[model samples]
Target: MNQIKKWISENIVVLFFCMLCIAAYTIAGQNPYVVASDLINRVMRNSIMVLALIIPILTGMGLNFGIVVGAMSAQAALIFVTHWRLTGVAGIAAALVMCTAVSVLCGYLLGRLFNRTRGQEMITGMIAGYFGQGIYLLIFLVLLGTVIPFWDDQLSISTGIGVKDTLNLQEGMKGALDAAYKLPLSTVCIIGFAIFTVYTGYRLWKAGDEEQKAGRRGRIVRWAGLGILLAALLVIPVTSAVIRRCSIPVITLIFILLVSLLCQFVMNTKLGQDFRSVGNDIHIAESAGINVNRIRIIATIFSTVLASWGQFAFLQNMGTFSTYTAQQNVGTFSIAALLVGGASIDRANVKQAFIGVVLFQLLFLLAPAAGTKIFNDSQVGEYFRTIISNGVIAVALVLHAMHKAQENAKAAAEAEV
Candidate 1:
């Protein structure tokens, strides 16, 4: 009973959101296939940005709202590529290269700022994001053709002194990654199950005798689940309308999967261990001879670079870029999505990030329909989404503060004893 209560306490936020999602889905009464399709697209577009928050959180840097700078980096690169009339994969590749370089520099500066404001990294990050946006605007809006000496009628203002408000990527730049390859949704599902089955079997085989025995039932259940899922995939009709209509963006998903894998792999490495050490206790980490500030900086840099790439993918998928406001909500939305997945200020993971993206995006998709159904006004849903996004972050911060206070109190009691 105590364990159950603890579990609930730990995951109450996730449980509440899950129930809320179900209610929204029921109220919306949308077609499952349409919902699934929309969810998949959103997941692909935003998952990387959400994942980028994990490392910084793990390093005790909180949600890294400074990632908006990274998004700005991506937009800058995209602007350059678009002006150069680059197209397709080559354009994306070039933009990524430029984005990486720019984000690294921005991240380093932001990291320094974070070090100066250690315990206040979250607020500092938010401020840094605003500062970066100001600089971004000044460059593109004021310095483009003047100090920068850039000239493109389509991209530049009438006076040729600055970039335009919107940049169309309908050329070959749009869907550059997503359109590279496609597979039926059913095929993707089958492949996913097959991979899971093999991975599960491999884990079982690799476990030692005692360990294997301890987890024997759990392993068997996992294998059974995989088998059932695979069998269903095989038996499901390929001629089904949904299966035929819905397709997966193979390359885009591969990129998302690779980022997910990278997140998992990094957390198991030495640097990742340092991140944990520093995050858990900076003073202890410094005493242990770990450069806590450096680790935090690296975490910030990693997150920034990933955010840049994520923003790049996001814009490409949309096939358009809003010059001034494209990156405005990157920080708020990504952090909120992460929090919605039940991650705290100091602890997050790839699974939580992905789950959060799916749920958050699902809610966003359903909000309008659900609102229209409930209040006969779709605009209410938009307002509801705005509230939920901002509210989730606010709520998570309060919960984190309470949790930290409880821990500190318990520690104080122990020391008194």
Candidate 2:
């Protein structure tokens, strides 16, 4: 009874929303298939990004507003990608690489800056994102086409100097990655594998399997064997025309797998230990000979760079960018998605990232449709969604603060006792 009560308390919001959704489904006449599919896609795209927020939280770095700065770096890379008319997975790859390099460089710079303002990391990140955007816009608006040389006339505006209002990569890059796989099968399979890998890694960490973690060569061997088996399973699909459909799914799956593994690896490194220690006690970390400043710099750089890749992933799907407001409020939506993914300031995990995306996106999927059915107004649905997403994040932050204060009080009391 206590366990059940605790679960209910922790997830009351999810339960209420879910119950509301079921009620709406029963009341409204909507296709279950479309709703489910849309919800699934939303999860796939958002889960990875939300997972990005989990690490910093684990290290007690707070929600990384610096992530937005990374997104800007990606957008800058994308300006050229779309301009070149590279549509398929190739385009996505080039853009990711470009954004990554740019983000890494910028991330290092921001992280260093952050080292100076340790207590105010979150606010500092917020300002950094804003400042980064100015540089992003300047490069896109000015140096891109003329000095950069945009070969793809299709992406250029009627004026020929600026990019078009919208980018149409449907013919070029639309489902390029998705098209590389076997319709929906590879898509699900790849994501499933990625999820499984992360889960396994989590289990390893939780069990405190130092020997297993230390066996780097053994892990590589196992991966190789698994790869051979997977390749065999994919033989028939490859022979058929289904190979194209596997492209996006394969790439996306690989991307997720790499990030998850990267996270796992980082947590085991000396640098990772530094982050963990800093989270526990900054002053102690400094005393222990860990250059607390250097760690902060590294973390910031890594976070922003990854954020840049996420933005690229997002824009590639949108197939367009507004010269004026392309990234205007994407930061808010992304943060909402992360918080909705169950990430708090001090603690988060891959499980939370996944579950959060599912729940958050379910609401997103239903908001317009649900709102229209209930309120008899589509615009009302939009209004509710906008308000609720923003509101949920604020509430989560407050709740986290309250929880932390209570924990601190309990610890202090125990110490006194």
Candidate 3:
């Protein structure tokens, strides 16, 4: 009973949002299949971006509002990709590669800046995103044709001075990465193989066998082998899902699962231990000989790179880009999604990312319909969603502060005793 109470106290904000989602779903009276299907797709699409926020939070850096920088980096890559007229997986791959490079560079810089403003990382990130957007607009609007020099007439304005306001992926990039293959049977085989690899790894480690005797080096090699195998399995399914056109985003779900598993796996590594240590107490970690600044930088880099990929994944599916504005809300929504999942200022995970996406998106899908029913105004639903999403984030922050305050009070009382 005490445990249940503690859990409730910890997750009150999530529970409240969950209730709102359920209420909205009930009131909307939408088809269950459609709603469920939409929710699943949304989760698959948005979860990665949210997952990207988890690592930085785990490192005690708070939610990475600078993920917008990563999103912008992706959009910049896609523009050149569309200009180059690269099609199919090649185009998407090119974009991913480009975004990865850009994000890594940007993440490294941002991480360095963050190290200076340590305690204010979140607010600093938010500011950096806004500042970055200004630079993005300047680059795409003014610098691209003149300074950057690209050859894609299709991607530029009539005067061929700047990039287009919208880039349609349907022509070249839509479903490019997604439509790489069609092997449902192969997908299942890969999943089974991945499961087996995991099981085998667990058993071998448990047995303290020859592999364990080799220690971290052997474990690293084993993990590398397992990761490669699992990645191969992911390819079979994700590529196949596009071809099969399953009701659910089967391949996308697999992608999310892979990412989630990767997130968990990373947390168990030495780096993850360092992150936990830094998160717990940076001063202590520093005294313990951990490179606090370096770890924080690495965390930001990972978050930015992952966020870039996540944004690209989303854009490919949507088949269009608003260019200038697409990245603006990326950070906000991703952070909100993480907060909605019951993640706090100090801790988060893939589970929170998934749950937040589901609950938050459910309310999003249902709000307009429910609003139309209740107020005979669909716009009411729009306002409701906007207000609620932002509201939930505010509430979660307050709850986090309160929880921290309570903890401090309890510690002080214990000290007095």
Q: How many residue pairs clash in each candidate?
A: 0, 21, 0
Which 10 residues in a row give candidate 3 its minimum summed lDDT? 239-248
Model 1 vs. true fold: TM: 0.93
Per-residue accuracy of model 2 over 59-168 as CA lDDT, tens digit each: 56787777877777776676677666566667877887898898889888887777777778788878987888777666656665778665446766555565666655
Error of 2 at 348 (Å): 1.4
Model 3 steric clash pairs: none
lDDT of 2 at 53: 67
- The predicted structure with the larger lDDT, 1 or 3, is 1
**Count of clashes in candidate 2:** 21
TM-score against native, each model: 0.93, 0.78, 0.84
Compared with the true structure, the alpha-carbon lDDT of candidate 1 equals: 0.88
Alpha carbon lDDT at 292, candidate 2: 75
Query: Residue 223 of model 2: what lDDT?
Result: 57
Worst 10 residues of 2 by lDDT: 239-248
Using TM-score as the measure, name the better of candidate 2 and candidate 3. Answer: 3
Residue pairs in candidate 1 whose N, alpha carbon or C atoms collide under 3 angstroms: none
- 1 against 3, candidate with superior TM-score: 1
Distance (Å) between predicted and true CA of 12, model 3? 1.7
